[model samples]
Target: MSDTRPWIYSTDHDDPDPRTPEPGHVYVQLVGGPLDGQLLDITGYTPEERAHGALLMSNHGLHGPGGRSDYEPRPGAPDRWAGAADTT
Candidate 1:
């Protein structure tokens, strides 16, 4: 599967939600995969979107090009997120 979706690098300063984020960038570390230790730059994502994480494209890693690495947000750490074996 591919996580191919349209993305834009813009943050809304006038956003009404205050508990999530304030228009900035955040990085999440990938763990057990070809993209291990690779930090994905989610510059224009909200907290909800961040929590969902993503299946990143392994273009230049052990999996080689066109490979997808599944990653999820580690609970209890909002500002700082790390990868793990299981997030349940």
Candidate 2:
């Protein structure tokens, strides 16, 4: 199967939010992707900020302290490209 795993993003250094987050809930880049690969761009940040490579909103619902089904992003919407900002 294609790799469709969920990538977890968090702003907390130690303890992240306990509640599960819906897909598309963006967290600024706390880290960067590989140097040679196409880094997923995220809005709400600068090029340097995007260079950091923010987390993609996971399709797999919530996780850990935040159980699945706890978060829900704008379902049935097209995936937003990186560098896009939250309009709402």
Candidate 3:
């Protein structure tokens, strides 16, 4: 059982969404057996952001950091909880 879903928890915005990977922020990669099959392609962020998640997708999303993004929360999605943990 591998965990491929990566995540990033930040305090900059109380409740940060894992789907929205920001640059310069810290995150964790779901590597290993327990999470090998749950992968979320987050190339929409930036190279640095994707690096934070450790997700290496094809060249279909953002490459580097050099743009302004207005990330809006998805409709009907539950509000992200705020807390601190091992964002590795």
* Candidate that scores best on TM-score: 1
Model 3, span 1-88: residue lDDT tens: 9534344422234554444556654333333322222223343566554333332322222333332212222234322111111211
Q: Give lDDT tens digits, candidate 2, residues 11-86.
A: 2446453233446644322122211112222446665644333334432323323222211122233232233221
Cα lDDT tens digits for candidate 1, 50-69: 87877655554445666555
10 residues in a row with least lDDT, candidate 2:
29-38
lDDT of 1 at 11: 25
- How far does residue 40 in candidate 1 sit from its true spot (Å)? 1.2
Q: In angstroms, give how far residue 54 of model 1 lies from its true place.
A: 0.9
Which parts of model 3 are misplaced by more than 4 Å?
1-30, 54-88
Question: What lDDT score goes with residue 42 in model 2?
Answer: 44
| Deviation from native of the Cα of residue 65 in model 3, angstroms | 32
lDDT of 1: 0.53
Residue 26 C-alpha lDDT in model 2: 49
By lDDT, rank the candidates, best first: 1, 3, 2
Which has the better TM-score: candidate 1, or candidate 2? 1
lDDT against true structure, model 3: 0.32
